[model samples]
Target: WNIENIIDNATLKYSVNFVEDVVNLDVSPGASGIGCTEMVISNLGTITIDVDVEVSGDNITISPGAVSVTLAPEGNITTPICALALTRSEARAHPVSVLALGRETNTHLNQVQVTSNFTAIVDPYARLSIQAPMPAKHCIGSTFWTNFTGVNNGNANDSVVFEVSNIQELEDAGFTFTLPILQYQLEPALLDPLKQNSFQNLVIKVDSENVTEGYYNMIVTIATTMDGESFSAATTYQIWMANCQEQDANIEDDSLPSISLIPTLIAIGIIAMRRRY
Candidate 1:
């Protein structure tokens, strides 16, 4: 019998599945974050397959972006793929695709490929900061007003409301607060191109008309919210309530924590990128 050679095409059957349809990521405002899940690849056909996996997304990165594996019939491989999102000032839902290419032993026989998708969700957050100038000493029974700043430190659009956190404390100490504007709408803070802080300015007025001759304190606060979550920030001060007629030596001048001015430019929202971190 004469020796003869026969050739036939081999089929590579494979299946791909993600652990879940959605992966949740909690990232700070203007920050990068990572989310990971398992992906399983199975070989179903009679022939072994060398499979290569790849993933892609917008403004985000997939770790081990590409992977290769050799599987036998009825064999499977499970690997974790991570999504590293880029710096963002707002929350968003992103869709990423997973593609698998299988070659029968890389023999270049016909190649079969499959594609699937998973969603990456970034959650929104709220943050705030308030700054006021505290004078070293103020004469008793004198009206005091100073310009202060309130910044929307969060990564989303929000409204900030101004209030006196220690109303009773200030009131009992013969002090009262009056503000022309109480609420303000602000946008996300930008770290670059001017280092926009989404900052707002207001004048704080206090009536020190009542008689006093001791140390007094007051707290100024700003508040905002996101998804029913409350966020509040405040600045406080302690002043020596000495009689205007008293000598300078009679006033206490110990400064606590040295509360100071708010810089016009604040570096905010430093996010991570590229690899799974």
Candidate 2:
């Protein structure tokens, strides 16, 4: 065992070190309709590295797959990352991941990785729709009530605004609208149907105590706006003027059927004609 003493030397290695921002990356509209952000990645290790990046999410893309970094202890690169929604109805923030993988330039070893998590911004979309049934006829001189169903089909919480499109025309034709002129707030449409308040009644008074036998048509509209996007819906109301008779509520006629009914003679004739059409 006299000549067996020998010395051996080994090198200690450090893995590649990388750094990235863990923040809410703001998204801006890209050339067509896609949303994107500029990502800054840095190398914080002693060795130079060649890195490749990746993303995990729907419609997400990274501009350059790989970049070379020289280390003065820190080297940075800027790249464009983009994301988008599959449909206009889909609006909300979504979470995604950014992955950086790298290896030392000289030995092609000391492999390492870094992960950055973020949320992509997609503004909420809002839409409104109104549905009202055709109303029944009543005596021309009494007041009446009509109603409509408002639906917020958009993916966010929003209110619907009401407008009487042909307000002046109908008013000139011996009709009046009390509901559209008033404020009716709507519950956010994103709630469950069973817990939603989406129905409303419109009131009108006919000064028909001396009007004619014809009818006037009324127009109603519902609308909403969000983040520069707009949506609107419309419905029609017809006012039938006949010294008909008396029955229930005593409301006039414009966007609703009155509570009262006309005489049996007028009802019978109109019922027969209505059956044919």
lDDT of each: 0.72, 0.55
lDDT of 1 by residue, 179-231 (tens): 67888887766433234548787787777888487776567788885676588
Best by lDDT: 1
Q: Return the TM-score for each candidate structure.
A: 0.69, 0.59
Model 2 TM-score relative to the real fold: 0.59
lDDT of 2 by residue, 1-277 (tens): 0111111112212222222222222222232335565566555555466666676654544334344444333666666655555444335566666566666667766566655555555565566677765866757776767666667666556656677788787676666555545345555444555445643445543354545567666677878755566778888877676665532324434446445644666789999999999
For residue 208, model 2's alpha carbon misses the true position, in angstroms, by: 4.3
Number of the top-ranking candidate, with TM-score as the measure: 1
Error of 1 at 43 (Å): 2.7
lDDT (C-alpha) at residue 123 in model 1:
66
Cα deviation in Å at residue 230, candidate 2? Answer: 3.9
